[model samples]
Target chain A: MPEMVNLKINDISVSVEAGSTILDAAKKANIKIPTLCHHEDLCIAGNCRVCVVEQKGVNALKASCATPAEENMEIFTNTNKVREARKTIIGLLLSEHNNDCLHCYKNGNCELQSMAKDYLVDSDKYISILKNYEIDRSSPSIIKDDSKCIRCQRCVRTCAELQDVNALAVSGKGSEMKISTFMEKPMDYVVCTNCGQCVTHCPTGALVEKNYIDEVWDVLNDPSKHVVVQTAPAVRVGLGEAVGLDAGKSYTGKMVTALKMLGFDAVFDTNFSADLTILEEGTELLTRLKDKIENKKDVALPQFTSCSPGWIKYIEHEFPDILDYLSTCKSPQQMLGPLAKTYYAKSMGIDPKDMVVVSIMPCTAKKFEANRPEMYSSGYKDVDYVITTREFGRMIQQAGIDFETLKDSECDSILGKHTGAGVIFGATGGVMEAALRTAYEIITGREVPFSNLEVTPVRGLEGVKEATIKIEGCKAEWKFLENVELKVAVAHGLSNARPLAAQVQNGESPYHFIEIMACPGGCIAGGGQPMPVNNNIRKKRTEAIYNEDESLQLRKSHENPEVKRIYEDFLEKPLGHKSHELLHTTYTKRKKY
Target chain B: MTEINIVKDAVKKHGRKRESLMPVLQEIVKQENYLSEERLMEIAKEFDLSSAEVYGVATFYSFLPVKPMGENVIKVCQTIVCDMKGKEAVLDAIKDKLNIVPGQTSADGKFSLMAVNCIGQCSNAPAMLVNDKPYINLTYENVVKIIDEYQS
Candidate 1:
């Protein structure tokens, strides 16, 4: 066992790991030290001086987050000088801050606002120097209001650390500092994946999702238009947190009821399209494998999953050369968009133009994904409006619907019906596991070798996970792969995707398929999921997704009757002409920045 | 050699490490006057640095401007020590001479004035740097003389 260091925090003795920070020791001693810049998931940014504490013998107050607790150290978490320093820092931060918390989206949820309240820093104690900055509403996914920024560097770190898409940077010196894109380009013009990872980590209203709730309200209010809403699998698990429900609690029924109360004509599930994606993506992978095995053709192995719009955009910008490696399947959000407009509309005897398909995603990137010009293969624009899970929550609240008290309701038939495989698509390594279930069953005509089909190797929150499956006892068609070791890798966060993509590009990759989710822990911990998101919360959300997958009756995509029926009635086969035209889409190579 | 090639050569000279970032950016700024967005992005890739990391340092240093600069750059120290020695008068003279405020460049591209931090010329209280060349013990007359030299 590691030698523990003993320290006294607030007159209470504490023993912690040798290198534990003073904040950690204080936490152990149950002495609450409020911190603004400290996040459980991010590296220690000691920039925010709110957590400064008085040390008995030290000359100056120490930042508890960055300072390590030494043996026999006497620390005072609550002291007059410490309180003064914190209040002064908060007051100074407020003085320079563009304060319109009354109308701010992060009014109640803001860390700075809460800290000011905690320290009773209501009155401005310093000379107020307000700076005006232009609000960037260029990207469909997210907005950057620099006027409200605190220069905490959370967004900067999130963009760089979590996503490896350094779309955000602190520009200007000292007092004139601001976070901006390279060359100070508009959000859409830069290589920003539009993943709201930055926004989720932002302590203020500086970065936020581009709101379409009002637009959604307008479409919902339109009597002539049929506004149908589809919720992504991740939304079911993550929506709970927004509506005061505990994390890891699946709220499918109540959420559907809430959406109905919000005046959605037909509440659908993106899960159906997720199941459809597995079918198409799986077939594409098998076909590619067969071509390489038989024709000896140079096909890109390690077919990367394209369910994540942020990951898609990242590959487009960073690894443009390996664009072909990406599976041509549109995200479940995009797929449901066209299907709602055409297939669902035609069956419901409504005009496709009159039907507005709205996707409630756990991603900001979905907004950008839905607006892609290539998604308009259904004659009319496929998906009309895209709203995040948070936006959906706001709509529910705006509609005066009691989310907690609402009775559980089921989604409308056809597009709403899905398998457990579809539900698990929200979690990392889920797509790979789901694809394996379908592929192994199709090829071997047997259940996936794993008990309960958990595929334990691929599951969890590791940045990069590799699993090898033995293709044993395959059918005659796939005889070439009999007893062949099929390797696969799963990566979440674009930072993780970078190395995987590079390996594939450089021909150093040793896998048959790769699954990449742009957000940290997949859609469950998506940029648009909830506020105050971290690793523990992500784990809870992941558990909820896994729980949801396990609770569902049908766990395999091929077993999804609606998906089967859609194939039999409309698309006919995976990778078919109609499927290619409607379900699958192409990618554009962006400038490598 | 082409401008892009020259930049690439400078990148090679500096080496593709984080420490080399400052030198690479400085050289680019020296050659290109200011770092372009596209060029910054290119340098980001060449150095394996994030655009944010590159922009952070590039923007933090006033000398390495992210925007276009005037042909002749003027930096006046505005620290307390410099202020006590009539740096403000020299600043006023430069502003009046150039017909611009600090942080603004003259329309003619002759002079760009900036009130910057101290250059450690405490012995000679007021100090300024003209195009990276330091000028010490400045008076309003000397400041005007320096601005006149740049006007030519």
Candidate 2:
């Protein structure tokens, strides 16, 4: 369908589509060109000259990343000159980079290290010109260590382009060049969402999830402490990729077993509270809808989901005026944190103080979320420590547990039970579909007519999607002439979310409810989900999430007996006194700067 | 009147895009000597940029200082030509006379000293700038004399 450009790469003629880079053409010709600055999701930085090649007439070595293929162009990918230039550039990068590869967090998994291995960099001919920079661990989530940075600008592009946060940028020039925040302020003082996408995309250990592994080990070793761990819905689908399983493989059972082996006294699922969130959030949405439709009261329509801490922070800082539209529920991670400390601890007869709650989240922001001043509703830090899936994977390896050999196991009781609806929260549009499944049944007194209760229209890797569900049949007492088309919209990634939030802010939004996940492709493709995330990986994970949902016997959140029991035992009712005290939270505005 | 209005005017003159940020800051630097954190915030707002983005750009250029500059900035040339012309002696003379190192400003806030590589004055051999006005082809005695003249 597109015009093809014929090019001779390494003396092999190849026809690539017009505008394909020399790298792409080279790949078509079975030539592998190494690159450090080129990322699948970011623009061609061309800063790393590792991919330099010889063009027929060009005097200088051409950067294949930024150079587009042309008709009849002769490109040499593995020329001696090209190789030497690449080695020189890599040597320069090595000179600047701290060579503490033996103990670096990204040692085995790093892209640059793999390239250095491929090129067989034998010597550091240049003197080390590494400038010492103090590691910034002020932010609860990410650690910024510029000493290992290669100045690739991948994180800069990720923050500025994908998230639109612009919390980091290329600050200095030449030898003193480094990535920094506003006035080089500490991360806490700046407007960083603490999403950890930067960490996900970083080629080296320059940026990483703050290590709570030591602290976790300390708490685990304590004889008096009861360590309870909850795995986020996104973690099951993502953790597989880290443990040598195919991306998007369902390893939930193995993950739970690993947590047990790691000495987490009780292994819980955030999905339990994810289902709990639906009960509270769905009830709140219906109440607001009742206020608007039945009482004609002033209420914020198109109520936003509060399940993502990054989205919560974005709205807090950028769109503070529409904070009223955000559901007052804490994120499922935050909800489970408090409940594990209070509800689960109380029922188990353990002192809430003695119980240490840790959440294995598909988010770095969860680390920040756990430390919020308001999360102390349980009389202590609700979640004692939060580790990312990446960190958990490391712990599993550290304990020498063969994840592949571990038998499938279920989560511990009390805060363990989860429904299919709860499991679907990993992907974008999942919560909306889950809520619709329950909300429609609650209003109609019948199951959703759709087969498998899979709302196909709401599911996918699309950035933004909207659907209208016509409430046709209804129960007697609630019948106000049913046939109402409930308008709803789903968006993943904050760039897509900003417009949707604006529409609601301007009173221009027509939908009654909206679902927004901050990271692209929801928690499954979250900033902290997996390394080297791409569209293909997200699609794979999305399929797995849906597969997980479809495989479960209980598909709807309302049907989760654990949720019903929690309400009957402690919560009493959704959006009631205890729910408001524990599950719901208020957000304060933050300065945009 | 507000210094921000002048900064806003500079923003207007520099074409009001993110690309114009450095130039706008440069103009503001010409007016206000250096960028303050508050002015950087204002420039960020005016350019519709993030504080980190604007601040990063501000810090990238060596000529633009993020902190306040002294009334008089003294440049001591440390280029090859000036080094051959006994630049270290002249530097020591100025240091002893002004009682300040290369990075520090004088106690009275009158002078800031920097040992710059070159100011495009290779022809002038041992040229230096005491507030952009070159004192070229200088001797160590002349360096001391120049500092005394400025101090008085």
Candidate 3:
């Protein structure tokens, strides 16, 4: 869109777009600059100071990431001064860091490990100042170990700018500087939505999703266990990247094959449960509207969708006073957990107690959520284990499974059947779109006009999105108006949801429905999807979700024959006693400190 | 339900809501001079959360009082900018005069010594907050006299 600027990096001339940083220009010139805090997706923090380069006329070495490239600028990437500064920065970071990489969860794949090797840092140079800081393992999704933190501000930037959730911030300064929540509270008590965007962006072992890989492996190895794995909608779009596949490549077949190799007895799909959620949630909305009009009964206004575990947790913690506004339906992942243990196990003639249900998700919060005591709705542990997409990839590598060569396979029957509406649940605004498709049909009692069901209002990467849908001519005259405008809002990241929640809390806002996802861009950019994600990758993954949605024959949730069959055979009806037992869940407020 | 009723009911009846936690903790600290383990456990159970989670959150933040505070709370800013402007000496003077450690409360409960990372008053250089009130441009000699004024 703009003119290109030519720059010489290590005596090689490279032309990059105007406003490109020296690091980007160097990348174009094939000159390597080691960075810890600078993520392509996250805004440049330049706090790591590891990418310093010697400029021709500058008095001091300039950080390549923060410094903009000028025309005909000469930069030396490997000068002694540049090397010394980088080494010193790495040395300082190492001195403060807990070098217990052997036992650390990040182990061999840690960026800090690779950076140290590339810079040839002397680990023992500086005297270590061991601050007796406590570890925060209070949250279900993440574990915060400040001892290993380099104060690079990657997590802060990811939380604030990228995710639009200011869950983490730099508190104090200098040697005492540490990242903390409001008043240094545990993440669970703060405004954090449990989105693992911070974990994906964290360069070191300081932040990590609590690992459930060991638990899954243990369950799989046990002779008495019948382990079943269900993959979420977003996992198929990004799991390919973890194994060196191109970003946004759909690896549903390879993912299933890999899971089968991982010793899963049956590979299921969470998409089926996603379709189920639309039925229950959509039916609930219609029932509320009907009752409100016919019986003059007051139902909960502004029924917030409870599809994202991170968003659910955020609302539970930050806006507990408005708990009634949240939809009672458990997330599709959570719903699948109970269904797999009880319904599927019974139908297959297997004992529910002997079944271990593992969910492969694009979320870190789902791991934390599965462990919540209330999640066991099937008289046994519904979901026994949870693994992020990255962890699943690591397991594939660990088990020596060739992900690329894996054969295409179909998901298990019964719980695997999904409509296009369910597949698009991977991206933000997808839930609203899917719900509207069903809602329109339910209201009209006929096929929705124009098979190309596109609700363009709720699409895009904006933190908050809104739309007003006018339902035309309905047969249910008592409750339905000719043009009943349904006001809806969708917010992805928790930071954006905070103000919206605050409005609902303060009674200043009114809406018919709301959809909130914890991670920015919804599950497509989940905390567990992939590492080193940029805006481009997120966009590509989101496009893949919509593309999958468009190519499907059954675009509406209500039209899925399997979903209707499940309802008739097992669930009985949407929000029925059986449905409530299987799909609905309650939340509890957490202590601030 | 009315909004006021909801807020009042939540504040008075539901003790577990996170929004109410800050206010409840403030009241508890105000009454007991510090947060008690029993109170924290009660708060945790009320919220359907673990005591460890509550304690971890409590200890992580700087505002929450874990131990009994003195009649007067003396917090000195020891962040980078303050350190550069001689906040350390000011802190040392207060500790020396009171004969108490940074986290200790005096025997008479007249003063509690603590060092905060920053008070966010960069223009004042070395600053101290006494019981939530800011006192800026603090010197070693000035700190002792300031405490003397609070003694009465």
DockQ of each: 0.70, 0.75, 0.08
- The CA-based lDDT of model 2 is what? 0.87
The residue-level lDDT of candidate 3 at A118 comes to: 84
Model 3 lDDT per residue over A1-593, tens place: 68999989988989999999999999987778999888887777888888999988987999999999999899999988988898898888888888888998888768888888887887568988767779899887789999878888888887777555456766654566688775566876665667898988888888988777788899999989999999999999998888878886777777888888889999889988899999999988878777766677977778889988888776776677899888889999999989888888989999999999999999998987888888989999889888899889889989999889889888887788788899989988999989988887777765544447877788889889998877777866524545778888999877778778888888777678899888878899899987767678888898888888887888888877878888888989999999999899998885332
Q: CA RMSD for every model?
A: 1.4, 2.6, 7.1
Best by DockQ: 2
Question: Against the unseen true structure, what C-alpha lDDT does each candidate score?
Answer: 0.89, 0.87, 0.82
Candidate 3 whole-model C-alpha lDDT, 0 to 1: 0.82
Residue A25 accuracy (lDDT) in model 2: 91
In model 2, which regions exceed 4 Å deviation?
A: A447-451, A476-483, B1-15, B75-96, B99-102, B114-149
- Model 3 chain A lowest lDDT segment of ten: A473-482
Which residue pairs clash within candidate 1? none
What local lDDT score does residue A463 receive in model 2, on the 0 to 100 scale?
80
- TM-score, each model? 0.98, 0.94, 0.80
Q: Higher-lDDT candidate among 1 and 2?
A: 1
DockQ of 1: 0.70
Cα distance off (Å), candidate 3, residue B72: 8.1
Model 1 reaches what TM-score against the true structure?
0.98
| Candidate 1 lDDT for residue A363 | 93
